[model samples]
Target: MRCLTIAGLLFLCYVTQGVKHFRLGRGKGGNLGAPGGYSGEKLPPAQWFKQRLDHSSPSDLRTWKQRYFVNDSFYDFNKQGPVFLMIGGEGPADPRWMVKGAWIDYAKKFNALCINLEHRYYGESHPTEDISVKNLQYLSSYQALADLANFITAMNNKYKLQRSVRWIAFGGSYPGSLAAWLRLKYPHLVYAAVSSSGPLLAKVNFMEYYEVVVDALREKTGGEDCVTELKSAHNQITAMMQTHPHIVEKEFRVCKPFEGASENDIKNFYNSIADDFADLVQYNEDNRISADVKYKNLTINTVCNMLTSPGSEPAYKKLAAFNSIILEKSNQTCLDYSYDNMIKELRNMSWGSEGARQWMYQTCTEFGFYQTSSGEIEVFGNQFNLDFFIQQCEDVFGKKYNADFVQASAEWTNSNYGALDIATTRVVFVHGSVDPWHALGITKTQDNDAPAIYIKGTAHCANMYPRSENDSSDLIEARVEIEQYLAGWLGLP
Candidate 1:
């Protein structure tokens, strides 16, 4: 049996409750949406869910805040339009994604009541006081699903439309996984669901993430040359780390020099690179329309443009330019790409850390969604192996958390939740070819109602983004199919 150390557990708990917020970006605030940007649209009152500390235990009750955004502008309960529920994810529940999301467009057309519910442990929802491991016993998907079950009951009871109104679920990324799981777990609540780019599978190691990124970059450049050049550049950087470490500090412009840093710091510097394309692929949208891109068009196409376009700078310098782009996007000034800072960012939730503590806990305990790289395909591989994550558990939460315990947790999660053998109905698993997460999503289906729509050249939850004129025909079709599925399930004419 594996165990967690009390010291690490106490440290995590203390960090959760008392970590001070330090200024990082220009606005001195964390980025919620785009670079240095928030919805600016004020969030509504957060409703409380009479939640249980542990769904399994059910004895410990807590008033968990469920920060939900509602738009009833086009509601027609008289017409009996279904309720469109947008399940929130790993980050704070920003209503702008719902207000400006493609799901809302469907809601307006369907004359439905649009609702965006924040996930448990995210936004203002706190099942426990401090994010200590002991307190985090209730922070699993099962607990979150139970909270949704309660929310459904509450919403129905208040509205007095328990049997009269239909419910449809929609979400992107992690919430996308929740949306689908909700349907599978409680089909009675969610009549139908649209899981956009949801990573439904659980695994200890996910090296294919960077492989997909490289493949996407390859397609954009019309050849393997782009990936080749990047791999070569990253190889040189890694070699330089051992031979002439001073050059890395000068080249990367990192806040702290890595002249005498630990292995974690080296891994962090590599992670900084991996996160660049990882984010772009995860949130990419239509490349044709210039303005619809929320992330300043940080697409694979853009990366290829930067890498391929000729400059007088050397190859290493060009690679450094790519790193610069990610640093700028991070919105943190004077940020040392160090492991300590990474741990700080992960632990401190008050500092606008995007629910990382909560998510990392879940990842470490339940879903090991760690995105690593392979030496054969990616630029920096073996540097971010599974042991790196195991060490992370040792350093951050507790040294007692062994690989065996983590691996067992992942297996148990898959067994309880049905990762591969998930039996469900009326779920539209919409994913893109370019999305790295989609590799773990529901790829095939035996049921006619449960279909997986694969879009080409798109990335992440682009199909779920607010539709634009320049939106690809594939995305348009996927959205249409979702509407049709919901319509069929809800018995709408």
Candidate 2:
């Protein structure tokens, strides 16, 4: 059910063609009834199809094997006035799941049906598999997009939609990637989309992005001392590895179940320490007085917590396997065996890991240190060729992969979504300056056939917040343009 609005009351009778049409205020004895036209006249099947999209076959999900539970209430575009198929970002979050308090109030002003479809292998819709590195190959971005497009067509057929509907796609991070893809793939289906904090660029470079953070620290933090400490730690970690590869291996391999660092897993030690220091700074940016104390407390507490939380058994094993194959044996890794094919496989694995939803491709590559043949555990892609890193992931995780899907995705990334002609769609890309995934924003890249705006210091989807000066001015402009474009199209004021 939606809150009543002025726009809602006025669009009660307007009908679009080649799609299902919904008329407002139509209920029992109110000139409209269930399974009938909004006017309550004996509607023809043709008219019925005009009002709904049909998706009843199980084979619709043949490739994925998950059942599509159709909600009849969901099929009602008439009651809702118009349908706005809303797809969520990746993670365990279902597309049907709505964060009531999180959505923008202004965005909700549009009276439309919102359908949130979950990805194939997350939450209750999980596929029956070992759910380890073994079966992750099935969860590529392309496959996920296919699932969504198929559903949309099915719904259109099921409902007998009266007119070609307009989709305004919006998502942050991974789902943001999907949104950008959808707009590119189905230009006719989507009038516009808002991609927030999503990097359409694949074959990511971790060192490059982390360098941003490192540089940001160096520039903002007043200290050659802190820089010295950082550089010293790096040198120490690197030096410690040559003679102590096994020790480094043992430390990072075991997921700390408890709190403090029991062993000298240099990588784990640093990650734990970093998280604490970041938490302190993020939570209390205004409390500048005890910042140093907070940092010290975080270091002590994080180190202590590592001992308690050593990490899950399976996670440690998987991590260990990665270290063993890719880092410890880089020569035998995908690097030597089949370099070209390996890169394609790497990107696919990014989304198919243990908890696919939480995996941020860019951030993971940037932060998760991988072992190199030099006995160094470095971040995602240290060098320029991202495909090399992607291949490393596949080499590390022996999951079944789709050669076609990988190749296709690689090509798509190379062209920068040029296949979609992003310029053709009335697309609006939004991003936050401080967002970890901000690198995913479409700046310095082709607009995918549309316009883009970046917000400063905002996190993913933070642009939805009401006006605040600290908010992205560009984001504000993009929204205004989006509103204007929609208004012009719908003939609304």
Candidate 3:
């Protein structure tokens, strides 16, 4: 639900705002800071590291090349500076991260070498020939952590680095969890970790995700009126669907007529509309400078303004207008809420399956982060429940991946990783109050060693991005606290 497109899955899918996809720190070319002081004439090229296909199996000697990037522009060989490893998430590893991001800035100041490692099965780091269900068995967080451990060892050998040189892991979103877990699982390998907007807990019914969205709406200006209008609009749409189906179809501009649409199709339509709000809230005021100009300024304030705008037109019409705005900006003609079409897209086992199928597989097999609308007094109706998502898993993969299997998988993940009760030190957990993912993240500090920096009036991974004049004071202070923690761990002044 978090990192899925409507064509690929359901719930929180607005193309760009799919979970950790938007938090890649992608931006225009810029100059590298400090020691080497290189210009943006050429960014770091992608390098490949030979990784084991199955880290747990000694019999399986099969190996594959994993994509990665290295930026040693600020490395001080004489001083033996520390190393910063930025972990890639559910999306591709952008080379710009080597020169950009708050971590890169710290690397420059501390004269540390920077490296970005692409996760296996993501981007071009495929371990197998294809993404078939059998091949995907090797893809899991356990395997990914093993890859990092092996990679760090290989890097240490290649660079001939001393044991004093610290290794600080950095990641956002799912990779954020990886960063934290990397330190917890292999504390001897990783010196410290910065986990930003990382959800440590795995659960089947993530109804709290939508509740945070509603809270974010209320926190923004004119949000109360917008919430009222949105609830009224949903009721109106529901009534029209039962009485005049054609009117409902025309209002939302569905690709197919509602006359022959199945119950699943109707459910998909409601979920799609609800997802628009979820997407907006999840990534509100997050990395907007890199966003498209049309929607770059779009936020909860913008949506509230649109919904609360006074006019003779009904609330439902305003909601439709908002949907049309999104469609127009995305260059889409009609909203395709076809459940069958989604299944067809997910069933594609090709290499170019848009990262949706692979992420969905991870969700089904390991983390059951299905964002459902089963909460009481939810703005979005109860159309998207746990059953809806579980059915999707069965439809896309196989009947074997049913509710029982998913629940068991989630339990396994929590049992193996320790979930919210993860016992680790020198790990800084950073989260934004406005981001819905923060609900599953470590907002409060369990101890002094594992501190939490909960930034107010910010969105997902706000502190990870480069410094902006428009950033909130809390975000700026949070970054400072993170740097201090890293400095203390690295024995810096």
Which candidate wins on TM-score?
Answer: 3
**Residue-wise lDDT of candidate 3 within 283-311, one digit each (tens)?**
67764232245676778898888888898
lDDT of 1 by residue, 1-493 (tens): 0001000000011112122121110011111232112246554454555655566665655465556667777786566678988776665555455456566678877788877776776656666676776677777888878877878888888777748687888876667778889998998788888887777888778777777877788765688767767777788887888898788778777777787788888876776666665655554553222222344667677776776667665556777777766555544344366777667666553524435566667777887766776533446656777787777765666766678877888899888778857788788888788777777788666578688888877876666655667677877888787777777777765
Q: Clashing residue pairs, candidate 1?
A: 3-400
CA lDDT of every candidate = 0.65, 0.38, 0.77
Instruction: Summarize candidate 2's per-residue lDDT along 205-236 as a digit string, tens digits.
Output: 32334443333333334334333444444454
Native RMSD of candidate 3 (Å): 5.0
Q: By summed lDDT, which 10 consecutive residues of candidate 3 come out lowest?
A: 26-35
Give the runs in model 2 whose Cα sits over 4 Å from its true position: 1-82, 94-104, 128-135, 157-161, 215-396, 399-416, 419-424, 444-449, 464-491
Off by over 4 Å in 1: 1-49, 286-295, 344-352, 375-378
List where candidate 3 sits over 4 angstroms from the true fold: 1-41, 288-291
Cα error of candidate 3 at position 187, Å: 0.7
Winning model by lDDT: 3
- Comparing 2 with 3 on TM-score, the higher-scoring candidate is 3
